[model samples]
Target: MVDSPDAFGRLWADDYPGDFLRDLAELGDRMSGRPGERRAAELVADAFRDAGAREVAVEPFEMNAWKRGSTEFGVTNPVERSFEALALPYSPSGDVHGDIVDVGHGTPEEIEAADVAGNVVVASTETPPGMDRLYHRMEKFGHAVAAGASAFVFANHKQGQLPPTGALRFDREAAVPAVGVSAETGTWLREYADRDGEVSLSVSADTVPGEGHNATGVFGPETDEEVVVLAHHDGHDIAEAALDNGCGVATVVAIARILGDIDLDTRVRVVTVGGEEVGLLGASALADTIESERMRSVVNVDGAGRYRTLRAFTHGTPAFEGVLDSVSDAASREVSVDDALHPFSDHWPFLKREVPAVQLHSVTPERGRGWGHTHADTWDKTDARNVREHGMLAALLVRELTRKSVPRPDADALAADLESRGLRPGMEAAEIWPAHWE
Candidate 1:
């Protein structure tokens, strides 16, 4: 480990930046359920081998894979105009022609009040006030399905005619056809709301069983308890999935390269998960096999290198605060931590099992998932400087986590923490709240 400031600076400038960028290039356009995702997993495993890490293996698992075909969305009444749209994964392939019902923000109360039966429900991709959390796209889609809506439309909060795409949860297919449109098109659709105009949506897709794999690179001494460093190698089929996860996996590889030579007391497992865009299948599969007691902590890098600043969601693990602070101090860079409960990424599976986990993400000023899960999520949006700096911070964090003596929270305490953070309701509504919480 380059402990001295001068050595660290030299190593950062001369070595890891190119390595990080190369990893990003190797895992190009790694969309889940596609050949690119499989290749990306192999690339991750290869990176571990190239880094001289031991016990490098690729573990395969089964998942319900959905492939995108084509989508058509437009308003046939009040004002006839075709809109650009993308089909949400696992959305059934069919056609639905019905009246448009605009439920602003798609809140549960708004959905309950709207007349959604046998009509095309148009809802925002963003969460509403009093929800106090970012509701998944699937959550709004679920409300439409429950209200007997014939079709569903997720309108992106951002403008620029960028339609967002995200999948429904694992193994659960949408009963109604779902499509995503831009904020401008959504606003235009809202104008016809007072008139309850007619609209039509046509989506084409297929669901099939496929194999997904997770690449695990085990290093350091063999110990009963281990610290797992994680990032998903899979992304949506729409774009490159650069900001959401390519940055994350790149950081993981860079860290493995830097820390490969360090001899530590505890085991450090670097795992790059797949099938995360459609669902947390890879992480869930891994979580099921490993005894939760044997896992010390998980540092999941999901939305890393998107912005210049680094932020971490500690998931209310107070003990993580000191480690994050110490690492930031050592690097002379800021690593902000939000001690709230965020249950959307690969970390959720392990964290829900009461194993302490932290998700590393770059802080963005936007309210929702901006430029992510959209065609705008391209490699050009990522910066090498951000990746290198966040990589240094994350490596420092992993080192600290491996050496620090931290207590894992029990299931009861984790459930209580979720409740205290005002996240249980959203999780329950999304059908992701842990069974112990019930």
Candidate 2:
């Protein structure tokens, strides 16, 4: 009945096209589960079952999952302006009404150019503009907080869905309150930038502080040499995560379909992490639970479908490098894998635990990875063929890495691999905290 082995391989390579699309479409119906672990647990468990996984169970952990209420903002400057805004999750709230400050989001020189201290600074919801847009507007927030500013007003959401429900994080935690304004409102604030007197902004919101939970699925018990696939399922609570990671989730689903039934020679775990938006919380949690000796490799897929590149970063070891190379070779299309390395992903945690890890993302400034965390990340951006290829690559890596049959890189070997890639140390040391954080 089956055509041929080559036919199946072609299908696996995503030449069939429709397979992963169908899989992603079905996940939309399932995303309605409560913003609780049970919802993610049940949904992911269902994915495991549908994909033919066995011994599936939900590993639960305590977390603080917060929901929002009425969050609002208004302005009184050279021109009276009013609009809506929401506080980022885990943000410290306050009834902030102060002189609007324009703190350009950059280095100490930029902060020096503006009177940012004790004023409500308004900058793009993001910072550095081009360094890494995936962090949303966090760099600016962190800078303002460090500058002793009272509050911040974001300008990015002026035209889109980012006004609220956009996932937020503070690198060193936040002390002041911040909110976004409508584009028209922001223009009004911009008008007051060099005026004779200061203007007041009245912003308030209903945000609570809480931790987030991650859901993990296992096909077998843990072992000394483990293979893991990582994806973040937590979303902005606005649109279904069709591409932002519905693709990664679908890849896991597809791999589960294939790996669920195989009697494992090595441990295989498919982890759908939570709150990758806030920080690498889920990955960090997994890192804490891992035994360095048991980990072989981590294949992390985030921002799966948006970009066309097969962009990757590796904690290179002979075996791990071989695995990445093999997958890269097998791909149907020559997706651009990059030389640029970042230690700022879910993969970072695994590497910290002495597990060789790599990330699958696309559209960086250098290699041109797609916009991952922005409002533009949506279903329209997803490509069924790409999603299927991701599944194939992940499955192949898991299979090849797990064979008792396969040789793994030692811990020292893994560390050296990461070091050579220029990712282990990641960003260079900074002299002082950013100035825009309030």
Q: Which candidate is the best by lDDT?
A: 1
RMSD of 1: 2.2
lDDT of each: 0.80, 0.56
Q: Which residue pairs clash within candidate 1?
A: none
On residues 196-286, what C-alpha lDDT tens digit does candidate 1 reach at each position? 7888888898888888889998877788989999899888877777778888887787677666655456889899999888779899999
The TM-score of candidate 2 is 0.76
**What ranges in model 2 sit over 4 Å off?**
1-37, 125-136, 157-173, 181-188, 196-213, 219-223, 260-265, 315-322, 339-344, 364-377, 403-438
lDDT of 2 by residue, 313-421 (tens): 5534334555567766765555455444445567766665556676776554432223333445467767777666666566665776676333443556544554464
Rate residue 312 of model 1 by lDDT.
91
> C-alpha displacement of 76 in model 1, angstroms?
1.4
Could you tell me which 10 consecutive residues in candidate 2 have the lowest summed lDDT? 429-438
